[model samples]
Target: MLRRKQHRFQHNREAHNVIERGKELYTTIKGHWQEYFKNDNPLVLELACGKGEYTVGLAENRPDVNLIGVDIKGDRIARGSKRCIEKGLTNAAFLRTSIQYMDEFFEEGSVDEIWLIHPDPQPRDKEEKRRLTNPHFLTEYKKYLKPGGLFILKTDSPFLYEYTLEKLKEFDGYEILDHTNDLYQSPLLKDHFGIETHYEKLWVDKGYTINYIKCRVQ
Candidate 1:
């Protein structure tokens, strides 16, 4: 309870910048939208989006896309919201909610692609089902991802990379477009996920390699 109150206080402090990212009121999305100067529009979802650095960076660099950064911590979203509004990022948003409950918000076939960046990689022997690669969550994501939509999983942990690799193999429809242990060694990583995460930067600084995959459900 104490922790919750602290988080709420921090979130309230930055309430002015964060537009509650939930879609429960999408009927008013366009109404409140700050018309971006860009002409093209594509929607992107970033699961487990902590500070939303990736979401905001991508939105700033690519004004042609709309980026939704999802994280459960209202306090963390507050920090991200400050950066977005300060940058005048018209194409980015931050949501305060659990990723497991995401399907309730995004409409079916509405999302263009996804960026699964540095997820917790839940590893409790009995909690394997909670991992993002769990089949149940995959099914939920399928409802939102458009046909041929891309999925990018970027991680510094070999365990998560290999685990997700096996998970994708289990899905007959998924086609692995590209994957590698050290994406910096390959040319495709730049084409897929774009920039790195805060943890990813630390990993690279510590000489840790990045393993990632870009795929699609056929």
Candidate 2:
């Protein structure tokens, strides 16, 4: 309970990088990102960004782009926001909100890239629609991602990897750019692959083969 209060305090106190619930900015920041970042850089989003590992990593790697981490957990978002503030990173920000309301926060064709890092597989047959790569989510992505924008998924679940592949195949105008059932063994591994999220490290330590897919929506 004390830790929750601390997180809430920190999350509310930090306005430079955190955009939490109950703020006017939460509803008004849709197309006014340039005013926030003070630049016209490409926009990238990390959905369900628990602790914002990818958001901070990508912001550090690509200063030319603006990255926003979106998640509903304020405590988790607080951690990432604190890290960004400590690192003095202006390109990284956190939005405390549910991923289902993504369209309300971003304009159509405004996102240049999106990363889904180790999202929950929602493995049960009845939970298929809740998977991040479900057709519904793909359509939501399509609504904001620019033409030829990249949609990258990194996961430790074979079920999700295969499910995403099947959905992408069925989805219109989604072109697969690269994929690997085992990311570390594949040549598709890039420099940014070195940044591992907390959950990713746990999965790797358990000898899970990380699956990765990169696609473009046309």
Candidate 3:
């Protein structure tokens, strides 16, 4: 398994859809996504995108938008990169980097939307600062997200759902567009809700409610 993982990482390095750390493109691609994607389509990012289920799904469903999946794990990114290549998804790409360094890759106000799908809850009180919706990370996201851009979060952890809500309230310039503790039962369900990540499926099968939030950054 270890060998296969290494092989996938290597394959991702060679794949056109992937930009791994230490590569020249990793740094040069910053603020030049239009050139990389060869289009001026609105850009969307999926952070901590393990396996990139949503990234691939969105690209397949929304051809008018360009999608990039960001994650630190190259082996995991390989799966989504391969799928995009197989399907000839030119508008989809993968970036292997930690979410903390997002600003380094994207220009200020360049992103149309940011998605956090089933992110780590960081349930421990001491780890609250590490949550994706924490004020710290939200500040980072604000750097790249365009004014009035969307920030969406979908998670199975009640702790994360409530924590994110509180953070959004405390943070200025964020308007909550919609939220639901149980998405499947909510009237706010949209077409995109049909795309389920691997983790989402697992939690749903176990009778866990899926929490969703859609907010716009000012």
Runs off by more than 4 Å, candidate 1: 1-40, 192-194
lDDT digits (tens) for residues 1-218 of candidate 2: 98786866576566668886677888899899988899999999999998898899999989999999998887787778888888999999999888998877899999999999999999999998899999989999998999989999999999999999999999998999999999988887683548898877887888888999999999
Residue 44, candidate 3: alpha-carbon lDDT: 96
What's the lDDT for all of these models? 0.75, 0.88, 0.91
Q: Which ten residues in a row have the lowest lDDT in candidate 3?
A: 185-194
**Cand. 2 TM to true fold:** 0.95
lDDT of 3: 0.91
lDDT computed for candidate 1: 0.75
Write down the RMSD of all candidates, one decimal each.
3.8, 1.4, 1.1
- What clash count does candidate 2 reach? 0
Please say which candidate is ahead in TM-score: 2 or 3.
3
TM-score of each: 0.83, 0.95, 0.97
Worst 10 residues of 2 by lDDT: 7-16
What TM-score number comes out for model 1? 0.83
Clashing pairs in 3: none
